[model samples]
Every structure is written in structure tokens, then in C-alpha cells.
Target: MSSLFTPLTLGSITIPNRIGMSALTRNRSTGTVPNEIMLKYYVQRAKGGAGLIGLNGPNVLGFGIKFRSKAGGKLPTLSMKLEVKFMLSFGIVSLTLIPVFLRPIIMLAAGVPVYAPSAIAAQGGRFRLLPGEPGYVTPTEIADPTPLIAQFKQAAINAKEAGFDGVEFHGANGYLVHQFLDSTSNHRTDQWGGSPENRARFALETLKELIAVWGPDVSLKLSPAGGYNDMGMPLQDTIDTFGYLLREVDNMGLSYVALVRFDEEDDGPRGTAHDVVETFRPFLTKTALFVNSSVTPAEGEELVKSGKAAGVFMGMNWLTHPDVARRIKEGKELDNAPDFKSFYGRGRC
Candidate 1:
């Protein structure tokens, strides 16, 4: 029996297998609310045999970005109720909802300025427009993160009310939390910035808030080596910052920590830690570590068998094959390749 098919305990919930589905933002939500199509999407993955399913929450408190859609909408409570209810009916997987704060150019049109730890602007990319572009704007430095922390706390309450098994904090991929963690994006002289400890304050504080509500059931996703959304720090700075952050998280006794591997082919400054899991594995003493990004089933099994990762989370594989876990366990071939062109936008769901 492959280790990937073995059970793993996460906080109060136990996943039947080590193969889990990572959160893939399918922007199929109706505005900021999750529609029936989105619910059906999650249910299919749960039935396909994912031991753990990570779902992205809709915009929270009108502060997060809505991909290619209008902002200022909250994740409807009813949507969570319905999605959790249907997914739990299968009784085969544990569900976790991710609360993310992403800022894109579209939020500017919604009268919301991009808020971050500093006023730095992200460089242009295929998905992001240049600073001189029509809607591009440098982020507004948040003087006080109290309200933002409150919003995440409320999101946790909402998740518990909706019967989710756990909550995953989106602290990776250059989102609000990631912005605060990286020195390149955060240049504040205040308590929230400057030193590595200060740079990790926002994320640690926010995790405290979530843990207060969900206890040990809360997990975090981080891209320490990621250069996405124009995020990168000096090699030592990356180690000192994320190294400190991971040490603190290890003390919190959370359920798990999912790390996103850096892509060598990506165009941007790379972080010091190229092999994210191997680099930070030493800092995580008690927490179960989950690794993501382009992981294959065979590799995933080896990661578990070798004890480098407690589980493996695959995005594109899960998106393309609903039965990804079973396929990996049985050594069956996967379905057709993912349609990258149709990854976003509606109509596919």
C-alpha cells in the first residue's frame, strides 16, 4: 500500500488519504457569491476521493479582490451552508475554506485602493498591468491593520457557522498577507515592518485571530520561494523572515502548513529558498507540512513515504482529473490535460 493512500490526522479531523486537492480559484462565483456551479465543482472533487478539499471563500467584507468581476460583495452565508452540507454528505473527505485577500486592477474600478503594508507597486506581468496602465495603482499603505484582522476573524466565525472542518489562511502568492511578509513589498518603519520579526507580525497576528476561532483546525498556505505577483526577497532575508515565521507557526500547534514550491522558469527575482519544503522543514517541529505546485502522483507518494510531507496537494491535476487520488493510488492514467485557456472566466463550470 502506498503511503499516499494512508490516513493522516489534521487537528480534530482525519483525512483518509495523503492525496489532497489544493485550492484552485475557479472564478466561477456569481459576482462575489458562490453559485451552484461552484458547489457542484467541489462536490465532484470530494466524490472523486480527495481526502482533503480546499475551497476558496468568496470576497470577505468587501476588502478582497474578485477575479475579473466586480467587488464589494460578501461571501454569502447560504453558499457556505449549501456547499459544506453537500460535500459532507459524501462522508469521504475533510473540507477547508481558504480566506484570501488579493488585490488586482479591477478593485480600483470598484473604488477600493490596493491596501498593503507599504505603498510599493507590483511590477507588470501577464496578469498584472504596468504602473502606467489605465487602472494600475500603487497600494495604499495600511496605517492600522486592526480592521483587516477583524475581517479575518469574522471570516473564521463564518466558516465555523457554516460547518467547515477547517480554515486555511491565504498567506502566499503575494496576497495581502504575503505582501506583509516580503521585505521587497513591505518597507514600513513601523511595528509591522523593518525587522524580520516585524515583517512577520501581520501574518502571525492574523493566524492568532483565526486560531482563536478555529483552534488547531486552522492551516496556512505560504509561497516563501514564490516570485508570483512580483514578490521576492533577498536569499538570506527570505530565510530569516520565513524561517522566523515558520518557527512561530510551529509553536502555534496548528493543523498543517502548506508550502508552494517556487518555479525556476518564472520571470522575476527568485527567493533564497528554491526548494521550499527542504529549506524550511527544519523549522516545522510538530506541524504536518503539505507541499503544493506541480506535484505529480508518483512524486507525491514518495514525499509521503519519505516523510518529507505529510500530504501532497495538487491543483492542475485535481482540476483536470476529478478522480486524481484514485488514479494515483491505482497507477491509472490521468484524463486529458487541463485547458489552460479556459481556466478562468465563466461557462466552463
Candidate 2:
């Protein structure tokens, strides 16, 4: 039985412990950038000895330079995969890159995979960022990812080159990638729209770029079966799309995969984590498995022991409990809830 404190490797990085600070959106970064506040937050978790520290919130692709990352021959999984000389330390999985997504609900409504380069009002009222906003904008005017993807890749490379572990692609949440993956938000009929493969094309492109810089020690946070953001793909298609990604990506030297089975709301005691893991197991090999959504130390223990996932990601929990790693190891109790106010709103930690 592997303890929560046991070390696990994802791609090239080996976490000090299994307690990871899963990425959470803190209003610290501007223009989808990581600022000093964000840096301090991660440092705090690292000092706490959390296994891994993933960047919280926003994947910027438009301001980056693109690279062909998958050519490293299925990228090798080194004992210290992405660790470098002098830099911020990270674990097996390093979450980066904001994927343009397609909400299940939005996809169901539009009958296709929604694609967005930015948060544009494509479908209707609920689609708009602000209240009562209308219709979607042109993909070009709304989002020119050519630039952002480049920036995203550079960011990942910087993290890795800086001596941190691998990077995690932020594919979940209603971010840019999420908007596109969901049909409700994306109504385009171009090569990047209509079909599932086409919808997945952009993501594939982003993945390839990240691999070019960070190699295969990468992980993606996907909601293929994610119910939040109104994901509406049929069981089969959801399975099919993920199958395609697994086949295409895993072979390219993927370190592991992290799936968000349900909306954050559906987590907790509902067995959402277990159920989602079951859904993914059929398609994956020995790749590291991770589940992030309101994870408790006890819950994480059960998950690892049950073989549901290889690692656990603590979101707001890790923020409040810097000593969470210590508590779990010492058999001490953890703070279930955190000081919400301090978690967000820039400045000092």
C-alpha cells in the first residue's frame, strides 16, 4: 500500500510526496500571466513539501512561439524527467498551457465541438462573459491563438529549463480550449469545427508544441467526461474522443493523464472520482493517473490504495494547509476548508 507521502513519478519528474497543489485560479496573474503572488503561492506549497506544484489558472497560447515538441521519439521518461540545473522545483506532472475547450452542455446544444481562441459570446446569453451579452464573435477577432500558443510553449520550456518538473496542460474549466471543445460555444464549420477530430485538432496542436519544448513529461487536465460547463458529449463519443487522444498522445511519450470526471460541484462522496477513473482505465496503459476535485487526505489514500489513480491534487485545500503533507504523513488531521479571502485577490500569499 503506497502511502500518500510516497514518492511517485510522472513523466520525468518525481514528486517529493503525493500531495500536489492542483492548479486553481487565483486572481494573481494578469493577461493570463503568472505574477509574484502566484510564484509565492507555489513556493509556499513547495516549502510545505507538497509532491508537485502546478501553475494555478489561465493557459496563455496566443503570446507564445510554437515548437515541434513531439519529435523526441515518444519522449523518454527519465527518473528526473523535467528537472533542470537551477530553478523552481516541480513534481512528475507540471500543469501548464490553457486549452481552448468545449463545454459538454454547449456541445450538446450546438451539436458539435465548440472552439474559441478567446472568451467570445458565440452561442448566446449564458455564453457571454458579462451579463446579458449576445452572440459569438468571429474566431479570428475573438482569438488569435497563433501568438498565445507560442507564449504558452515558451512558458512551459522556461519552467522546465528553470529546473522545475514537467508541465500540465490546463484543458479543463471554461477557459479558451474548453470553449472550443464544447459545441454550444463553437458554431464554426471550418476544419477546426463540426467533427470531434476537428475540435480536438487545436488541442493536439498545442500538445505537440508543448512536447517540443518540455518533451513528453506532460499531463493534461481534461473533462472529456466532465459534466461541468455543460459538457454534452454522448458516452460513446466522449469515449471515442479520449480514445483517439490516448492512442495519439500516449504513444508520443506521455508521462500520464489527469481527468476531471465531473464538475467540481459533483465531487465529494458521490463516487465521481472513482467512476471517472473507471472510465479512463480501459483506455490507458501504465501512465500515471491523477484525480483532482476536492480531494481529502483520507480520500486520496483510498484512491491510491484502490488503484483508481496514481496521485492526488489538492486545490484550495493545499493553499490553506501548507503543512498538509506533514499532517498526512504524521497521521494528523487536516483543515477541510481554507480562508477563502486569502486564497484569492493578489498580494503576499
> Which candidate number maximizes lDDT?
1
Clash pairs, model 1 backbone: none
How many angstroms is residue 152 displaced in model 2 relative to the true structure, after the best TM-score fit? 3.3
| Candidate 2, lDDT over the whole model | 0.54
lDDT of 2 by residue, 119-236 (tens): 3433221323334543333333234445656756766765553344567776665445554565544555776666667666666787788788777677777766544433345566
What TM-score does candidate 2 get on C-alpha atoms?
0.69
What does candidate 1's lDDT look like per residue over 155-239, in tens digits? 7776665555777888887778888888888898989999999999988998899889888888988889858767788778899
**CA error at residue 27 for candidate 1, angstroms:** 2.0
lDDT of 2 at 311: 79
